[model samples]
Target chain A: MSDKSSSRSSGFDRRAFMAGAGIALVPLTARAAVQDPTQAAAQDPALPVEVTLRVNGQDKRLRIDARTTVLDALREHMGLTGSKKGCDHGQCGACTVLIGDRRVVSCLTLALAAEGQEITTIEGLATGDRLHPMQQAFIDNDAFQCGYCTPGQIMSAVACVKEGHAGSDEDIREYMSGNICRCAAYPNIVAAVKQAAPDIMKG
Target chain B: MRSFLYQRATDPGMAVQALSAAAAANNPLTQAAAQPLAGGTTLIDLMKLDVMRPAAIVDINPLARGWSGIETGGEKLRLGALAKMSDVAAHADIQRHYPVIANSLRLAASAQLRNMATLGGNVMQRTRCSYFRDTSYDNCNKRIPGSGCAAMDGVNRMHAVLGTSDQCIATYPGDFAQALIALDATVEITGKSGTRSMPFAQLHKAPGNTPDIETTLQPGELISAFSIPRRWPRSVYLKARDRQSYEFALSSAAIALDVQDGMIRDARVALGGVATVPWRAREAESLLKGQKFDDGLARRAADAAFADAKGRQHNSFKISLGKRLVARALQQASTMEV
Candidate 1:
């Protein structure tokens, strides 16, 4: 009975620790400013601009902070959490999405700037219940261990094949160098891209 | 990022007007109250870090329809400022006639960044100096003027060796500017007054006492286009970095040689990753001109390139590394098939 109680308390502590860690990522000054309603009201920009982003075959009309990036708009407002923000900065490609047939880091892209473009996220890669060929290929090739980077990798891989860079392993590696895989499942990722290239190119 | 206002400028005049309306025009371009948003790769990143706090952002991307073009015709190669880096790098004409430009763009950042970044923003990119980027370090003179430099005594493996001053030794971290400087490109600037052109070499100011002021542009000036005179068929850009790709150069060389028969008629040499600005090695170029290609000549040219290079404690390797790159690039350019 004592052991069970201790284990429950330890699990609660772990959960609290993780939540605290997550909050710590935001700067102290920003947190303070956000918590203070008066300061937040004063610091808020002129107005929350209304923007209509055509995301994943659907137009998402949102009124958000002008400073909001495409990545934030997708994840926070539209509930399209497929595009993960590994690094809010442009260093990591986890926030990569296709805008008008070109792959770009959505983190650096302002939501206002991407107003008219057709934005495609990882969530929109498939049709109905059928998984995208690239998704199927990733599964078949065992391309990931932790699936955190899989969405970005798969999104970048589809574009890589479409861009004619999937002709060789070297080409795929160079083209897909933008999306980094922390799991280092590069060999399998390359194989998966290779497997999906012909099928993706055919259509 | 601090928010103020965002406006879309469809024309050059409208953009200049919006930029000029903001206060603090006398401030350095980095600290300007208003900034033109192109790719937002540099501006957005810096703003998020609180390194740059522009109150107004003019969205100049709407002008890309008229500004994003690559015309390799007549005697000059005209590249519009808004042309995406990936588009310019993958251009067949650029790859064939000016491999230096193509390869420089190819080897920079990553495909996703290249697709987003424009040529204009790429050249105007700030240094990757940790002191400048991180606001926690208050000793950065580039960020806050008159503040002491932390990178001087701190870990500065990526600092500048050439054109460095006592105030700052932050390296200019761009590959495209080196090629432009080597090929003697001319930048066209659009302002409220009118359009004006200047040599691309004169665009970037070295980090002197006022490390804050980085460029020669006046307030509201925008880079409209870059024109390269004559074709550089035997040019090459070689970068040596910590990683194979997706990293800035430790040392790089851009060499363009005009060889007539067995002798060299003219040569252009520019060094990157070791300088505070896009450095033109005129001494090295003069050494190569009217001389036959040989190991001894290449060595002398390389030596002349780094004759005045001063390296800090951690970045001293760049001097020797830069010399070898200059020499190797010359050899490659001389033997490379046009």
Candidate 2:
């Protein structure tokens, strides 16, 4: 609360301490704002990150643009095209994916942030040989037609089951409101989510 | 869609420094316009729509620690800016302690977006002006400075009429802001120049000729948190939107009231999706400051809020709707047991 406390002025000089401790600068914030640098050796753009995604249980390495979105990374790069890009924005949940078992809109998630993270695309819904319970219920309950929004709906449904949100039809609708079914498959989708409630819980 | 460089700052100081340097390096129009990427729930979407075109994205996610979490240690409760809307709503501490703030964010936008967008970004997003978003048009001072505002003469059912000029009339959108203002919260901000803390009232300003200058934040300043003092009170967030969920409010009210034996001790209130800023109904609050929490008092307070309301042709219905929202929110808040 004093002028001394007001201006330590060292809040952003972590590299100064690192050098005094006989450690190399982390280059984290050092080159972050580097402008108009001509030294090719010193101005190497921060290393392009290589991330290995364990989507479901499959392992894959991605040569990703530093700014590549998770939705684009999955759809365009990895070819897990099941997740639709209806909005390519976060408004529509057509690109929902599970990051570390939590459902999120893949389009809004940055791929670089997914480093060392467990991800589950819509393709990872089924148990290899058997269609996942949610997937089967959608078929049984007739939850689609021109099924453009099915993949995202199924992904969110799987999440609802895992997160214990499938208590009732209304709860399913509330939890899955993020997924907009342009085909207006609301009644059937609600029934499908309800039917999968028990099997999803049994697991 | 020209992409320049990207850097994620690990902390507040680093983020401020990076943003300051970038802002200093370029004018408004440059190859290095720096934008701090908060949830990007709206920013990324706007960019895809070609509404905004920032060259550099300064990732503030690393700075999320500085802006998130709730601390209820002192006379005032603190809320971090990065706390997810869903997390804030579900947090037992926030719900039991300050349900108004929590509920406002919870009922805002959609569930998935609530998880992605930060409270800061939610507060700072531009109005949903169709002309602003349309790159094909040459209008919107907020979107393209000095291009002229098409919203002034166009379909402006959602535009702000209380604070308007020939320059612009876009509505100030966001639901969470209404709750903060109603609670008389203090916004804690950090920038390269220094740190400043002030009432949430100071953070927002009315649009005069400069409709593009939306907020009071400096070039490199970042909102770290908000603080609200604890007092014996009941509060509620009332939003009337196109739908019950996943819709922006046409008009919303956040009301906080403290009463004893039916007599009011204090009333702090604000409104959203109505004015140029989160409209604080100080006049209305004064109406109930020393009055009882009865139907008459509620009606008087609500009436006082809109006594000075000026509405555009399309949104004149909001005059009655906004007043009703105030009365309803107050009645709902009063119903909560002390």
Candidate 3:
């Protein structure tokens, strides 16, 4: 009787462990369910755009609404929130990202339009633990105060350097004017971009 | 934003047919059901603001294989509709032969926007008039016909000073169109019927009685390509804006000249930010022709350009700004080393 009771107790413990495991997985599963475009499309027939983006280095397949902007797709769906939504309009460049080798304001770019294209966001700038030279320069120079527009500034700075528009202080200021720093970190931001130009161009 | 249907077209003809089929089901006039999506900068921006509500969008990027080329052949420059603004601006041949074209594209929206926006979309870009963009105001004739123009009396500092009627006073709000109009570029359009070409000036209609009807394009028609017949090596585009970069022009000029032995053989002039359309200043062109490009001559030409310019209360400063832009543009173009 004791052996049987012990066996039953062991079975009860196993069940309890599984229940705890399921409770532990609740947040992760909820995030996946919310973010999985296929799951969302299965629930709602309205969103029909099946966009396949080669984001950073992964091929991310999403079935999003046709009106979903690249910025929303990156932040909301892909769980990459490094790119901020400052204005949602194209006026603010906080949502800037690199498509192939060119920089684009992702807020105005539709996810459906960016299908099958390579995208590089602020999250993609680091190599494992090491930060990109531009990101490092931004940090070293203290380019931002509030740090809202830094991602876009770094993204645009990388492109600006690659495009050879970082020859002078005035050129960097003119080219990087799209990414507005509301904290008024213009001089520091310019300094950061100039500091990183040589290393970014070498690559 | 409202839910909408989306379709990507592999073929341009199929895209037009799909739009036609959608428009036929509903009144294209009453309902903006189907729209061709190029660079969604303008359309999606307006959509999110609740200003433009399109029920279906036809993705035309698949046509980029055949439509995104920038060719300088056959004594003409052929720019494909789907070509990105930055790509066209950075083309060495275009920059060498057409400085005004390059300069116009360069001075336009931010670099990030230019990378995403297309040449076709740039020309078809709607006015940045705040009343039309902000839906809080109820009286935008362009947004709702016969609603009356709120910009007529309210906050019209950015409004057009020329080519404006009683119905609307929105500016054209593009720099590239000014260069196209000045150079006498032709727009190639393809529709259900076939391909038809029209002068770039006729592409955008002035704000007359019907302020809502902006472009003459048909429901299913798509702008295929733009062709500039000849190159204007001696040309310059000067834009006077509130800021030096990443801002729309307050007064901009695109001027091209063919001068021989210190005498002007031909001159093309266009004005932006002060006009309701991509304004070709033929009066200014006539004034510059056969005249020595001196400060006095340029001043007279500038005066002729704004001869009929009737400005509203807040926008009267644009007239003076527009004249100075014209005079300065002429001097710059005449002195350009080809």
Query: Interface RMSD of the predictions, in order shown?
Result: 12.5, 13.7, 16.6
* Model 1 alpha-carbon miss at residue A59, Å: 0.8
Which is the leading candidate under TM-score? Answer: 1
Q: Estimate, for each residue in B1-338, the C-alpha lDDT of model 2 and write its tens digit.
A: 33335666677776776666656442332112567877778776665666666655677876776578878775688878887777777676777767787778877877677777887787887777778767677887877678898877788788775566778777878888888887778998888767789998888767778777777887778888888878434888889887667888888898888887878888877888778788888899888988877888888898888888778768888888888888998899999975
Q: What is the TM-score of chain B alone in each candidate?
A: 0.99, 0.94, 0.97
DockQ score for model 2, please?
0.16
In the range A1-203, model 3's lDDT, one tens digit per residue, is 00111222443454477677674312111112122222332332242446678899899987655567888889878999999888888888999999999999998888877877899999899999999999999999999999988899899999999988999999898889899998999999889988998998888
Best by DockQ: 1
Local accuracy of candidate 3 as per-residue lDDT tens digits, B1-338: 66556666778887787666566453333235667888888887777777777666777888889999999865689999999999998889999999999999988999899988899989999899999988789998888888999999999999998999989999999999999999999999989988999999899988798888888887888999999999899999999999889999899999999999999989998999999999998998898788777899899889998999998889999999999989998988888888
For each candidate, what is the lDDT?
A: 0.87, 0.74, 0.84
Off by over 4 Å in 2: A1-54, A57-59, A161-164, B24-32, B231-233
Residues B63-97 of candidate 1 have per-residue lDDT tens digits of 99999999998768999999999999999999999
Inter-residue clash pairs, candidate 2: B67-B80, B67-B81
Is candidate 1 or 2 superior in TM-score? 1
Residue A155 shift from truth in candidate 2, angstroms: 1.7
Q: What DockQ does every candidate get?
A: 0.25, 0.16, 0.21
Worst 10 residues of 2 chain B by lDDT: B24-33
Q: Distance from true position, residue B64, model 3, in Å? A: 1.0
Candidate rank order under DockQ: 1, 3, 2
